[model samples]
Target chain A: MTTPTPRANSGPSGTSDAPAVPAVPGPLAALPDADPAARERLHARLVDGAERAGLLDVAYRTLETPVGPLLLAATEEGLVRIAYGVQDHDAVLADLAERVSPRVLRGPARLEQTVRQLDEYFAGRRTRFELPLDLRLSTGFRREVITRLPDIGYGRTESYARMAAAAGSPRAVRAVGTACATNPLPLVLPCHRVVRSDGSAGGYAGGAEAKRTLLTLEAA
Target chain B: MALRPFEEIVTEYGPMVLRVCRAVVGPHDAEDAWSETFLAALRAYPELPEDARIEAWLVTIAHRKAIDVVRADSRRPLAVAEVPEPAVGGSGTGGPGAPAASANGQAQQPPWERDEELWDALKALPRRQRAAVAYHYLAGLPYREIAAVTGVSTDAARRAASDGITSLRRSLPGRTEQRTDAGARQRRAHQREERGERP
Candidate 1:
């Protein structure tokens, strides 16, 4: 207690009623240990209620895809962020809390359609993503580049220089690479389609290995 | 600076809120109280003032939810499940809970529901005293904040906590005798009983 407590055991517990508040916090500091199972159950219930009430500012869930575990997050606007394992899921959520809304919570229902589309893409049954996206994190030339990413088409690669030309910045080839490397919605946006001009796989935010995996999966 | 995600708030303060809820509503309904408190917190989290006392804010929400759970519980008196504190320290597993449960055929009690002598003592106190002790001792809220929470004057909050702890010590002084494990103390008290010694 910030206020100095009266001396403990003021002449024992002899006189009942109005003894000093225990001078030390030791008496009750050892509260019962919580059951982890109970915590999880309550947390999930809270998430469900928050989601239904529209208080879940950013709901997220992860999916194990061929590329790796992808962290999908959404706002009331639509799907806002999809981070690769290489991007660090924790840091990605924190960024969303800063860039989107601080009221982030983990509720999978909001991302169900996004997860289905990602699964179909990984399984080779889907060639294009139809999910609504929130790309507010991007701006200016970079935003323009990623906005045009879906035009590259599935299973087809485009030269970075060509992407720059397509994005109305023919000389911004390096900017195109920068945009692709930072594509907040990577696989769904088809940043993987933006390749090195020499027909080789290029640097990717999901790591070069992940880039190879996505390309190989699509090639088959 | 950006406000922290609500999930972090839950992680940091959830257990403490649960403890406060348990003291106010007992274990059986504490989870329900906890769930309701946090759901309400999450709903209004967007507007929570940045300088608000996070713990006190949570305790305030918890205080209200605890009242709701208690009111709902009162309707089902038979289901209130008031297990009496054992006469002396004994394991919850083999303590007086079994005989007591047998009488009600509630022997199949959930593990978490058994043997909280501290909660029992806190439960026995008057409602305001229990809340004052909880928000002050368990949650470490100052009497002014406790006054804000329990709607009492600052001096009254301080009085309620003192009176509450006075009764708590009378009820379970041995529970606080040693800073060591309560289980160890109970087992020692039980072992002393096993030898027919004056415990």
Candidate 2:
């Protein structure tokens, strides 16, 4: 199948060229279709500095992935955000300020339960999360994409065509891919579990290597 | 090294950050998390080393801010009790949660039940595990970074995440049953409504 053209607003390079759009967050453009484990390692390394800088909360994670640490964060009302990569420091923070709230603070004093819960998860003790999420950041089709992502089974993978079918539009496979690409919260929504019908690893917003790593980890 | 004011950073990466936040928390909470992340970034930016990578720094802040939001929000009662079965929102679904089945007026299932179930599943995992799952599965973080964020050794983090997945897999059967039961009930309710009878 012919590759879908990048979004109209994207630059000639297919990366967002808006002067304000700093280097497209992660190594999305530079990625090559390859092994999952290495990509996971790279994804892990990329986000270290950001986590240390206190830009990330280091909570709300899933176990053993191909990519580096999974940091899921949110607003007081619900999950409003998530982040990846070591270099995502400013990017993650910038997103929160622009989307979640201006009253942000560092104290887990507020996210006490979430922190505790995350601690429990990493300990290999807990399985699921029980948190409220504020989904104000998504709307229209995007919201639909996230809301529907959870329907994918754990361990099992689906193709874009199958995913589109599950999402209720057999014809909108490309749109579903876009949704996956644009997904804000990848794991919680379980986007990595998605693959091409031919079993080829598809594109991921977090980077293809990261995606491969996640798929491998899941397989492991 | 001192970093540029967060405002400058936000102006530059606002949309990307919001996309990340939105990916994790959904749309409704993104605004608040976004605000919190940037504000926190602003307060902490000055302390960052000059050689610091701004993008990573911001992502770290955003992740923390997002956790704060999830924690606080978890305190409130969830709107629904059942977690949705994990389904690919597929490109056909108009994104992830597009009202696909309902869009073409196909056999409509209650989206609320699925939403509740999915949220509960994510919330059910411990924070680190949840984050790992979120990153690898959702945000697509690798084991190494997941280790860094959660303060575990890379292997430990990988194990923790794998363990978490195992747990999800183990629990998924049970959750699927519950979800199925819930879906059946909803379908019955719809049927009841169609019959035009209310007790």
Q: Specify the highest-lDDT model's number.
A: 1
lDDT of 1 by residue, A1-220 (tens): 1232333322223222433333323345445545465566667767776766778889988888777888999988888888988889988887888888878887787898998888888889999989888889899999999999888777789999998888878999998899988888888888987888889997999998998998888888
Flag clash pairs in model 1: none
lDDT of 2: 0.51
- Interface RMSD against the true structure, candidate 1: 10.6
Candidate 1 structure quality by residue, lDDT tens digits, B58-173:
99999999999889878965735564322121122222433454456545554445556666776789999889877765666766678889888877887888788778776665
**TM-scores of the models, in the order given:** 0.77, 0.37
- Model 1, stretches more than 4 Å misplaced? A1-31, B72-112, B116-120, B176-199
Candidate 2, TM-score vs. the true structure? 0.37
lDDT of 2 by residue, A59-175 (tens): 233223335654455554656555566436456655565455432333333355655655564444444456666667667766786677667655578888887777678898888
TM-score of 1: 0.77
Task: Determine which window of 10 residues in candidate 2 chain B has minimal summed lDDT.
Answer: B174-183
Q: Which ten residues in a row have the lowest lDDT in candidate 2 chain A?
A: A24-33
lDDT of 2 at A154: 51
iRMSD (1 decimal) for each model = 10.6, 20.2
